[model samples]
Target: MTLYRDQALKALIPHVNDRDIVVAVYQSCFDWLQLNPRDLNYVAVGAMGQASSHGLGLALANPDRRVIVLDGDGSLLMNLGSLVTIANSGVTNLYHFLSANRVYEVNGAHPLPGADQVDFEGFAQSAGYAGSHSFTELDQFTEALPAILTAPGPQFVSMEVMPGDAYPRDYAYIHSAGAREKFRAALTRG
Candidate 1:
């Protein structure tokens, strides 16, 4: 079930805002954020495995924004270069969150390149991400997520979320640049 996804997103609401950034997130997990397009101070690219890189781009673009990259372990393996790039950029406002089920759950949950075989925390630090850790349950994630997100640095946090891909029906999406700008405005002036 997607229950864990909802729980994780709910657990993260206290740390989110228009000034914050979240990229490359799954629409399923993202749908749980309950954000209006008018609140989009960030960008979440489509397709898979681009959250870290996209979040990295936003972090580099606006170092002041608290950039959150909702990554998938499968996706991280797709573009390992992003970790190195983020580390090299020295952007301290980024947090890479990976929901690992050890498979491409979106693409039929098939085994990804490394899937369950890789050590993402080690990978993050070796690539100079500064900090990295893993969580296996919602309670555990909740206890540590805030500290991780607020740590004032770049990190890759992998959580062993329970698996399911039940995305919301008839939800909203930000497809225009103007909409994103308006969202930023709403967030800032409110």
Candidate 2:
């Protein structure tokens, strides 16, 4: 059974904390904001597939803190090489979560190319990630999240999900300079 994106993120929220830096993009950003709005949340505005790259930078810069990246399958496809870069960078504190809804939900729910055939977990493992997991059920994802969060470096989790209708897409907030400034201020405050 396909999980709902919101439900999947809800399962992950409890595992996240104040010190953890969350880098979110696209539809995931909207849902995450609604679920858990925090100061350390870095919303990737206009950068299609750079959430993982940004999370990698944050993880490398702040080795003491964990960096969680909320990425979309369609967006990840825009820069699949990021998986290799993240794995090779040797950042153990980064967790890359891909919401694989098999479509570009933000762009009017268009079907993604090779959506059904793409093996995100395999790609990460082949790219040299320390661990990789794929979950299609909420129970399995929730049950495994804690261990996954604590396991190893450059972990990849692909959750097979469906589009959720609970959250509004606040495009203006995500693209605003004020939002960026807020995140910057939060980081600097540390």
Candidate 3:
């Protein structure tokens, strides 16, 4: 969570569009994106890797806009088909960033139902992302993120992240109506 959030903020330094839409898994990315929530279009999906799927809908509705999905390894595994759907559909403005913390952090680090074993980069590529890459080193991650984000198509990137405690409280339940409306309007342009 630390490294993913750290690097994501750094990566976002140069590519943030004034009206781009961003959705991150609940508690996975808000701390990072919240640094400038109003300045950048974004949302927090409480359901985990579903951010990628949600971003797909936004991208489909607003193809001209870039949609960034900040997801978690545990969450992404829960719904890998979301990736296939993205691939099979042809919507290309979505970028999925997964953090391989390797545990369900919010749930006291419990192992996933199926031994919790997975290879994110491989899974994403196999599921249809045009290009998938992994990052174990912080420097390499910062360097590669922007290119993948801005290159003009669906791409997947996973980085090894450090787990942190959950947010002090739930924020998704506190969605700002104005922000929601702006985001919805942005997508409706599709």
Candidate 4:
């Protein structure tokens, strides 16, 4: 019952309110976000493994709306400390979604050593997250997501996904500054 990356993301779509701010990192998430075209504000972080920290900041700054962090396993591993920070912040509206495909899916689907060995959910719990869950199948994820999203938490959800296509080259135009300005503008307009 291996879930594909796209499937896991698709399952999450129904739970997100249009007003939630999404801070996505890595290629797959960016690609998905582009295709979905949400009216919700989005901040795309170009740097690898930085989305959690950025999402934490955004969650803290905008405590009213949920802050969805669409992150990847490789990226999360790169900054495990961010989990600690997020936990310590005690932000109730932060929803950390880690797409664990066990590879750097954007970079030609390269294998990520020890990715399968790490217990990301346990790590998050140990780091003091209010809630944490892992899913390998889409059905259970779909059933559980709405409650998880609505619950008061700095919740952590680690979904195991089968790697999919690399991000399309033509859709790579969004960068850090532009993304920041766009998200900031959206925030200001409200």
Q: Pick the candidate with the highest lDDT.
A: 2
Alpha carbon RMSD to native, model 3: 3.1
- TM-scores for all predictions: 0.80, 0.97, 0.82, 0.90
lDDT of 2 by residue, 1-190 (tens): 7688999998888899888999999989999999999889999877689998999999999998899999999899999999999999979999999999888888888999987799999999999999999999899999999999998778999999887666988988999998899999988888
Among residues 3 or more apart in sequence or in different chains, the pairs in candidate 1 whose N, CA or C atoms overlap within 3 Å are 38-183
- The whole-model C-alpha lDDT of candidate 2 against the native structure comes to 0.91
Worst 10 residues of 4 by lDDT: 164-173
Judge candidate 4 at residue 143 and give its lDDT.
Answer: 92
Better of 1 and 3 by lDDT: 3
Note the Cα lDDT for every prediction shown: 0.69, 0.91, 0.70, 0.79
> Candidates sorted by TM-score, descending order?
2, 4, 3, 1
Best by TM-score: 2
Q: In model 2, what are the clashing residue pairs, if there are any? A: none
Residue 163 displacement (Å), model 2 = 1.6
RMSD per prediction, one decimal? 3.4, 0.9, 3.1, 2.0
Please list the residue runs of candidate 4 whose C-alpha ends up more than 4 Å from where it truly belongs after superposition: 39-41, 164-171, 176-178
lDDT (Cα, 0-100) at 73 in candidate 4: 86
Residue 83 miss distance in model 2 (angstroms): 0.6
Candidate 3: where are CA atoms >4 Å away? Answer: 1-4, 44-48, 113-116, 164-169, 172-179, 185-190
Q: Is candidate 1 or candidate 2 better by TM-score?
A: 2
lDDT by residue (11-46, candidate 3, tens digit) is 665676766776766545555554545434556555
